[model samples]
Target chain A: MDEEIRARRAACTDTFLGNGLIRPRELLASIDPETDPDTYGEGGVVTELERHVAALLGKPAAVFLPSGTMAQAATLRVHADRRLSRTVVWHPYCHLDQHEGQAHQRLHQLIGRRTGDPEHLIALGDLEEVAEPVAALLLELPQRDLGGALPAWDDLVGQTQWARERGAAVHLDGARLWEASAGYERSPAEIAALFDTVYVSFYKGIGALPGCCVAGSAADVAAVREWRARLGGTLFALWPAAASALRLLDEGLAEMPARMRHARAIWDALAGVPEVRVVPDPPHTPMMHLLFAASAETFRENARRLAEETGLWVWPSGFATGDPDVVRAELSVGRATLRHKPEAIAEILSGLCM
Target chain B: MDEEIRARRAACTDTFLGNGLIRPRELLASIDPETDPDTYGEGGVVTELERHVAALLGKPAAVFLPSGTMAQAATLRVHADRRLSRTVVWHPYCHLDQHEGQAHQRLHQLIGRRTGDPEHLIALGDLEEVAEPVAALLLELPQRDLGGALPAWDDLVGQTQWARERGAAVHLDGARLWEASAGYERSPAEIAALFDTVYVSFYKGIGALPGCCVAGSAADVAAVREWRARLGGTLFALWPAAASALRLLDEGLAEMPARMRHARAIWDALAGVPEVRVVPDPPHTPMMHLLFAASAETFRENARRLAEETGLWVWPSGFATGDPDVVRAELSVGRATLRHKPEAIAEILSGLCM
Candidate 1:
């Protein structure tokens, strides 16, 4: 790899690893060829790893899966089955609606009701207004598409109550719950406690290898375990990889407030730029959005050029917004990106725009 | 761990790492502390491993999910859009129906039409009889709940053609495709080429760290990728451990016919045992069902005892069949299981009956 690409990879790894950039050479130094799959057994280290994650999530059990799409869909299916209801309610922009092409509809024969307004958090009023009985209400905390905004604590409590009173289960799409918790000043357990089921990702704020945990009452989770096996989620073995990431990067939860602070600073610095417009301005969580006047293609080209020319990987490319000219870029403040102060980022943005 | 448990663990790891039981310990001989997720990076090796898997699955493209329930459900939802026809059709004993609690109906606003007969494979005749439009048709090769059997190749092709002619897509629940491939004597690519999409698992015939892959044409897989992100499958990173296993154990695919031949041998030998009944006698694939006169619980106890006494694991945990006294055990012969001769397995079964 070229020096620039190598540096970029190191920087990306560093942001995730939460240390100084780990060079390609350093990554090579860590591999053990002897431990390759050709020599391992089933239920060895992998099984122990799965067990640790299950414990951390406070679920009676956990099964390691290949993707969250399978995990969340399966979990929701279990909840729906337990209640014997066919309808699930969530916001219009909820991941299940906007992203999963309706797999639930295609595969499980379930119905999803887009309950709330497109631009706002799902409210209890939306649930109350819906005439059809639902099996579950899925709540995405600090909703990602809406720029990481979460409903108030009372609203969340009321929403849960509203769903339960109607015999529906509440599921928290806590993918970004780590960041959401920082904004709420609530513990993971505290936020998760409100919902009948909670789904949390290991990779996002925690920066572990990609994985997630769905926690709930023992019976509910047990049902999920059975569903997981039927859906082919049960692997022959798992290791402590997710658990190790949880133990190591879980400390990042404590560090999130600082990252959020940094995000706010970056947002503040960039907002003053004539060509830059910030979405959900002031930043509700560690993640914020910057809308550039340039087209997405141009914005991506400029970002790639900056990375190639200056050895800095700032801003992800090709984020979508309703507006065509407004190129959306997420400002996620990890250890590596946080290395350069808001001023440094501002300088780069200004230079790119020029 | 006790010596027995430790030995079991070592054996399992060896199976995953690609060596037979005795050589399993040799896989983990190399270790570097600095790269350990618990010691340095945010989470640990598992998290990193997930990222590698995400990339390998050709997802934009992966998450180390906790279960397939979540993974498949998420993928199904992505396929079933609200404005689109919200229906999925599969066999009667499909994992989503028998296992996932009607999640498709409860979660995605999709309806399920169980099209095929329990005794026969899904045919184009089944698809032609359906009146309502469906979003997708799920095909499980070597249908698990039924005796391990497959539809005629032309029939499978006809089913996919029928579904797509109506603008509906076809999905292959190839959980046991490896065995099915051996039975069919076709390549994975050849089998996969038939459907609009396919879901394959790593742990079954491959005997790797548990993982799965959903592959399709670029556009279809691309859509699944987007859904994966929305459903929380987009973890920050992934563990390469499962990928490592895939790299190593995929070679076993070439050797599957040998295993299938051995499975038939075991089936033939067991047919002579008075108390034991084999389904699809002589074996349709490498896996076969051995029904016993005891109940599932009794069968489990006996199997456990047998495992304790002799280092062999023969599974006959009763499934959702009608007979109470019947215990169903699947004989899935891998390289390790094949180590013992068919007569040896038969001798063990004879002892269990006494």
Candidate 2:
């Protein structure tokens, strides 16, 4: 490949694979360089950003955390303490269970009861079947790894009420709740109000620098703040990344619905491709999985090659199905990715398969 | 107080309490505002900063995380998984056990055996008494809440060997390791080499933005990276604040000893004060506590008032002594806080007592 093409391919792949491409010139235009550090400290810009997020989510307060790991762990820890129970109930595929290095288990000693069937979203019936006394029931809206499937609105409300009746707090693992909101055709506040606490990320659908916020009642948030400090989450200084998030919050949130619409269109277009199979067909949100009649290794190699040739990037690996010859890839249509039409993406996949 | 004075007091208190004030100008000056998003992410300037930290700590790689909570929790989780043991041993005052809301217990389900007397630093003899099969022995170099005391160097090495003999990993809770290194007259790399894993903070003695690094053998760090991502530590980006830490790595590491020297001097001077009694007298590191002839509430109120009047901030709460009239205050002498001479701080305290 020519050097220029390789560089382009690398740039495109880096953007699509990571948080997104940071255009140096564009970012500088938005923020004042001189005040970045101080603007992120106590009573600084990040604090202001937290207030904004709290209000947006209909919560009394919010805190900007460096990562979702600490934010979610801290939130769940508070809930467990308040209930005086160490058991938290959630789907088996919940991020806290699978991704947190068992932090929920290792750091907090909070036991988990996987309340739902593995293959589906948590239903109201699933909540009723859990045998253990749960301190909190975590709901992942538009569940990832399940092709962004969401329980029906009434079912979600019913499940929340079910947990409440049993004196369990409901936490929405809304890491992707931005995208899920579009699927539910509700406002962010509407979705947020359904749970006692909600965790939202700046980087996922919002495309900002990495950060997360946990929003809840004043007392609960104050308790989380204390826990945050104890856990060393209270940094002496925060980067003004939250400033960038404020901008993304304004820019990307409005575009999420359009991205979700585009995702459905992409699903429809790709369904006809002989070599492509999507899970949870017609994805409920702006994300979906594309299974290909190729090994993961082969798919990645081909995807890399295609990027080199076309300056576009697509994931080529995901959960394994039964067949050794097949591989899955997540297709997340963000604002930038949506620039390339669904038909164009389908055509690229078709070319690669051929 | 006049509004202007009140504003000045708040600003000065914020500066005194802030972590990034030491080299804020130089730190902010080095950042490239023109970068797109102007935030931290892979391949961003901040990633370069983490790379520099990894090399300085003699680890194969390092990642910039938001807080020590995630860093320590993630590090311990990796050790537990590798050893298939559920227990971690540490002093009762260790940050993980006391400060993290039992996150190591509640979130990770990792049991902890408090190895030593709470009032003293963990010695080799203390490790000998831990009967359970532990996954890791967590050592806090220059123990904080216990007045920055350290076990003898040989004792630490012996403890590492002791844990290794039992197939357990050794983790150093080196939040104050920078100060501890100066007191021990040892290099950071030398101290890091004694353990399977070590966690260091950028904001504490280093005076950088809030960030931490976990260092170990290549395999151990790789395992931590996997856990980091699983715990949502791997977000969209992490670059800017990490860059600030990188800039401070060279500038701040050497200044710890001066701070320690100042702390010792401060302790010596305060010892002569009629109403003040120093704990762990003569100082082990750049931190000590003053047992005051006042109540905790009175100390806090006075400290807040001093902060308001003198634009100086000192910790106002500590252990309660047997006497109702006496309270303790932790005195941490950092690079910036040491700007005012020891006599000046002691004189301020003497006046406050009168």
Candidate 3:
């Protein structure tokens, strides 16, 4: 099944997702070749990016890293070292626990404790119930695994406050903070202000080359920079990634609010499609998850047929759900989705249902 | 002194060094934009690079990494875990010991035991002296810190055999193996065959984007791949670096012999200059050290004046030696250096002396 998708990938002409399917070369082409390359993640566009991100996040400093996994781990480790507590609290579906191969424990000697239910956002009560001391509370803006849902503003504040009162530094896994910014009608800095440290990814919401930055006080960021060097995240030249981020960052941010609106339009139209359901219906951010009332095989066959007939690429296969009959797919509103009318997209997606 | 160099860097028209003073953009432009980007260091050019490197090194598998620091650390841990030993033997000036922020000790909890004299390659006698159990013996080909030196081929074979007899895996830190290949007149695979695992760097000699590959048996490479993910060396896309390496690797290897001869040409020419001395005289590799019989301040002032007058950038400052009056600079024969006659380069270098 996996091999089938690879065989047919090049057949599709238009991708129904962010930017394009294969984009590194185009991203590199967009960069200003004249920009001096970074040496060991220092000088040139890398430093410029750090300074710009620090200002955007309203933090005293920032450090660029190869991946969000590295950024988040180093930030958490720095906070833990400062507070002298190894336990860090997070939601059950957070990237650190689910996707990072236990790097926090294996590489950094930090312990991760889940505080929230698997299906819901982290609440004040969940954080308060944690009995042990915590070095940091890791919060994901627009929690990805929960279908890009962000908690209400006051509830968000309450959760952070609980950790702060208990001497735990609040750290943000803001990989999708740009999407959250549009959802909350707030600047990234406004949401970031509540956290002691923030790690935002450029590759996702910013549509840049793969890279991220951890922003916080000058002291904390300096420490992460050292950790980055130790972890080998400091490459000889980070300028290409930095330059790509610089090139697309402004346009990506400016287009997010419209993407958020576009997302709502699609969801609202899908309301008439009985076989398709959206989590966090009405769409809290520019992204959402769609549940199709069809088996995985049925969904994949439909997706392949659509790609072959219309030259339009959709999710090849989807994540399995608790119900064997249903499959889940992610749709993050982007330029291609904006090209079609909301009613038209709903019709296309409806074609996938059994 | 650093500020002065930074201020005059842009004034130079040509660089008296490898490739050029600033080379990232040119290296990127050489890559084919149509090449697919890697996803999490899998597929696309990243996999292509891994497969190509594994076959070239005569290994079963390989993994592409962002830096040699991560590659070497992961490889060492893999060997240690298999041997059930925590101690890894190395030279005092090895990258893991001197440059990687003690990552082996801090991140992996592996104890490093330096067994050789700081001034020479690891001698067979040094290995016999270590009575403790050893997990691996790390040997750097064309040892970068020691003026890009190599041990005698017979002695190298003897050392690895001793480690193998003790049930210790031999690992090659072949960061400059391309240079060493030309020096030894041996294929990289020929040298790599003596070790259980081999790490080769592309950024230094290949003049490509910053990246490296670890080649070994399928199981060991898989283990290092897992460690790479844990350490966050796995980015969303490693294509740009991988593609750049693919584009330049063949040409870089083909040019090594010429560069090696050019290095000896310069060395022989410098023999007449009286004020300059060459370490490992007559040059074993394409890279060698030039010890200037002048104070640090004098070297800086002369380098600045040379840059201003000839528009040729040279080393701004040099590593201090035991002698207060002498400073050491490395010259690795490259495209930029190839443009000049050996006598002309010698005259230019002579200008820097008191």
lDDT of each: 0.64, 0.73, 0.88
Better of 1 and 2 by DockQ: 2
Interface RMSD, one decimal, each candidate: 9.1, 5.9, 2.1
What lDDT tens digits, residue by residue, belong to model 1 across residues A59-167? Answer: 5655555446656776788788877688899889877777666767755667889987898788777888998778999998888887788788999999999988898
Off by over 4 Å in 3: A1-3, B1-4
By DockQ, the better pick of 1 and 3 is 3
**Residue range with the least summed lDDT across 10 consecutive positions in model 3 chain B:** B1-10
Q: Model 3's DockQ? A: 0.68
* Weakest 10 consecutive residues of candidate 1 chain B by summed lDDT: B10-19
Candidate achieving higher TM-score, 1 or 2: 2
Name the TM-score of candidate 2.
0.74
Top candidate when judged by TM-score against the true structure: 3
Error of 2 at B287 (Å): 3.9
Give the per-residue Cα lDDT of candidate 3 at B44. 78
RMSD, candidate 2, Å: 6.0
